[model samples]
Target: MRRGTGHLMNTSVTVWRVVLADDGGGGQTEAWAPQGEQPARLSQPTARQREVGDQENAHLTHVVYLRPGVDVRRGDQLRQPGLRLEVVAVFEPSVRGTYLRADCTSRQAEGE
Candidate 1:
């Protein structure tokens, strides 16, 4: 992922379906809401994460600041457990950062 290198970027965004559980107070509660799906704008390693989080993801992390129409408060999709995202966004020149690998990005969408 270097500058001026137009690699496979369009298939870079990681799309995920967010199921938000409501905080209900009754015995029969906790309804799941289908939040609008969003993508994880990926970027190259910052030299810091490369040394951390073992070597599985090695240095991959979602760039929250670059994701448009996404809430900057909390990365809801990035926080979801067992969530493997699918690549959908048509890649173009990001006015923010560079996307790295497609291993975790190019997944098929989950069955509804």
Candidate 2:
């Protein structure tokens, strides 16, 4: 636990990276490879954030908080049970070593 972050991450999500694999036809196919799981706290965007996303047609949905040094990045996929979120952006606090935040969009159809 880092300072006040004790137990803040109440759940874990598996992080997946899309890799290009040889399709044996001189072409590559995108494949989802698990990058392992990490502790995370998934939250819905606030009213203001939601409004901004709506105006921009971004469909931004969840904000995921993870401990610093987690191997996550934009374009990665975060998955838990019935939900899948596509990571849109990754941010680090100015103070550093506090936590990492990921702005994500819901991929409802993929989960179905």
Candidate 3:
């Protein structure tokens, strides 16, 4: 997607990575560390269902657009207000490299 494609990216997302932290018991705990923030255009969420084992899993997927050359990787997460999106894949959707697309999955928050 181009920068001037009439899509106003007013929302900013903070990128986070899971890191191992010492728990003082010789074990490590998975914690989220903020990598950085970036301007992103969030597409409308799409819902789908997939069969896993013997149960069906429902999840939402969103396409996030960011500037070209952004170092986004799989397993990273994008955090916005009241939303957390786990990055499933990252690729350049356009041939001109104007922006990068991050395919993310959103599930219901715990205890919801």
Candidate 4:
């Protein structure tokens, strides 16, 4: 893999991490803090459908590819223009430090 091969990654996305901040009243507030932005490619969306009780629910799983050394982790989020994807897992698909692949799920479909 080569760095120049990332030309297909045209989507600009913001990476965010969840932080717990003290609320000053023996509680904490969960907030999303922006980590940074990166050029990424989102693809391979698969529909996951299941039945809970008498209702059927569906969610989408997508693969996100980022440049090497992009500090993305599980539980982080990637936000695009009209989409919010929660990172479920991260891995180096090529194992050559060329890029990072994140398996993400749609936050809206998860009812989050």
RMSD of each: 9.1, 2.1, 4.7, 5.3
**Tens-digit lDDT string for candidate 3 (9-95):** 667899999989999999999998999999899985443322221132224367788877777898999988788888877888647
Question: lDDT (0-100) at residue 24 of candidate 3?
Answer: 100
Q: Stretches of candidate 2 above 4 Å error?
A: 1-6
Residue 99 accuracy (lDDT) in model 1: 33
Best by TM-score: 2
Q: What is the lDDT of candidate 4?
A: 0.77
Full ranking by lDDT: 2, 4, 3, 1
TM-score of 4: 0.74
Better candidate number, 1 or 2, judged by lDDT: 2
Query: What digit string (tens of lDDT, one per residue) describes model 2 on residues 1-112?
Result: 5484537999999999999999999999999999999999999999898888778776789999998889899999999988899998899998788899998999875436
Candidate 3: which stretches are off by over 4 Å?
1-8, 24-27, 45-60, 94-96
Cα lDDT, model 1, residue 32: 29
Per-model C-alpha lDDT, please? 0.36, 0.89, 0.75, 0.77
Q: TM-scores of all models?
A: 0.30, 0.88, 0.70, 0.74
Q: What residue pairs are clashing in model 3?
A: none
lDDT by residue (1-112, candidate 4, tens digit) is: 3355378787878999999999999999999999999999988654331122113222336788898789999889899866889887787865566788887777863454
